[model samples]
Target: MITQTISLYNWTNGVIMIAIFGLVCLTLIGILINFMMSGKKKDKTEN
Candidate 1:
């Protein structure tokens, strides 16, 4: 029973870590996309 509990805890921890990593990646991607889009707009307005 103890082993099972420990295993469950480890599994949940791994899942949480993966989820956090995914969120960070998604946020970075979003910021990069936003920057690129704004840059294009600036160029268009200048030209």
Candidate 2:
């Protein structure tokens, strides 16, 4: 019973780690897109 509980704990931790990783990846993509769009607008305005 103890071993089963430990196994479940490990599985839950792994799932949480994966979720955090995915969230960070999505945040990075959004920042990159915003940066690119802003840069293009700046360049167009300068010219």
Candidate 3:
């Protein structure tokens, strides 16, 4: 029973870590996309 509990805890921890990592990655991608779009707009207006 103790072993099972420990395994469950480990699984939950891993899932939480993965979720956090995914969120960070998504945020970075969003930032990069926004930056690129704004840059293109600026370039178009300047040209």
Q: Candidate 1 residues 1-47, lDDT tens each?
A: 89978887687789999999999999999999999988875455766
Model 3 regions more than 4 Å off: 1-9, 43-47
lDDT of 3 by residue, 22-42 (tens): 999999999999999888654
Which has the higher TM-score value, candidate number 1 or candidate number 3?
3
* TM-score order of candidates, top first: 3, 1, 2
lDDT for 9 in candidate 3 is 69
Which prediction has the highest TM-score against the true structure? 3
Q: Rank the candidates by lDDT, best first.
A: 2, 1, 3
Q: What is the C-alpha RMSD of each candidate to the true structure, in Å?
A: 4.1, 3.8, 4.0
Score residue 40 of candidate 2 by CA lDDT.
71
Question: Which residue pairs in model 1 clash with each other?
Answer: none
Count: clashes, candidate 2: 0
Task: Give candidate 2 misplaced runs (Cα > 4 Å).
Answer: 1-9, 42-47
> What TM-score against the true fold does each predicted structure earn?
0.69, 0.68, 0.69
- Model 1 segments beyond 4 Å from truth? 1-9, 43-47
Q: Please report, as a residue range, the 10-residue window in candidate 2 with the lowest summed lDDT.
A: 38-47
